[model samples]
Target: MTTAIIKPQWSPLTIALMVMGFIIFWPLGLAVLGYILWGEKFGGSPEKAQAYWNKGKAWCSSNAPRHHRNHWNRSSGMSSSGNAAFDDYRAEQLKRLDEERARLDAEIDAFHEYMANLNKAKDREEFDRFMNERRGSRQGYDQNKPDNGDNNNGWGSNNA
Candidate 1:
């Protein structure tokens, strides 16, 4: 009988490092930093590490926002200049976008008008007659030929 051998179960070393981290590092900052840094080395993929950090950060922020207040703020907070120049820049961008949209709309309208004029322009019989006349002038066909094969349907032996 054959027996199957199971590989050792994989477990992340993050928890142990985190515990030791709390012991050695002042304010447990190193522990958190180590978790972030060596998480992939221990057993996590970069994606998994990122996900774990994101979830952990969220939980930590909720439970103790003031605990790692600096890290928490750096991660979550946003800063933007409230200057008049910034507001003007935004206004200019919006105005340019609006102008571009208006120009595009006008171009679309012009194209539609051009297409409508083209579509309503000509009779099929008139167009065919014009083409046949053009071809005859260019080729100079033998008028005396019986042309029975061509039969005025625009094809076959001129002698016919």
Candidate 2:
């Protein structure tokens, strides 16, 4: 017959801490702090950790609060409105990114068409004319140059 040894009976730290805590603060301290810490080090699963934490929570809720109940309520669970807001912001950012991607795609398509048109250009004169047309007509300079003379009223005088 093969005996499959369970983990709890073999942990040395649990025994030591349990002894120390038992000697110092008796059952309450051993169960509360020492056992929990030991269990955290050597315990199997998240459920056990939660159990330890739940024990502490139950103690605190019952003993600490005078009247208020810590039962499941609308506002009892962990709030993630901040995260939800962040998610909304993230969605908006993704939407903006999609819009930008579409715009860039359109621009790329237009650029490819322009390049194709340039390649099909008849001659050097046609290419030069096309470049000049794409550059657009330059704005005519203002012929009326302003005379730099002190002709304004004395608005800078101290009128206080």
Write candidate 2's Cα lDDT for 116-142 as tens digits: 887777577788997887666432222
For residues 7-59, what per-residue lDDT tens digits would candidate 1 score against the true structure? 11223454455556678875584656554665444444567667767888898
Question: Candidate 2: misplaced stretches above 4 Å?
Answer: 1-82, 122-160
RMSD to true structure for each model, in Å: 16.7, 26.2
Tell me the whole-model lDDT of each prediction, alpha carbons only.
0.63, 0.62
- Pick the lDDT winner: 1
lDDT of 2: 0.62
- Poorest stretch of ten by lDDT in candidate 1: 1-10
TM-score of each: 0.28, 0.26
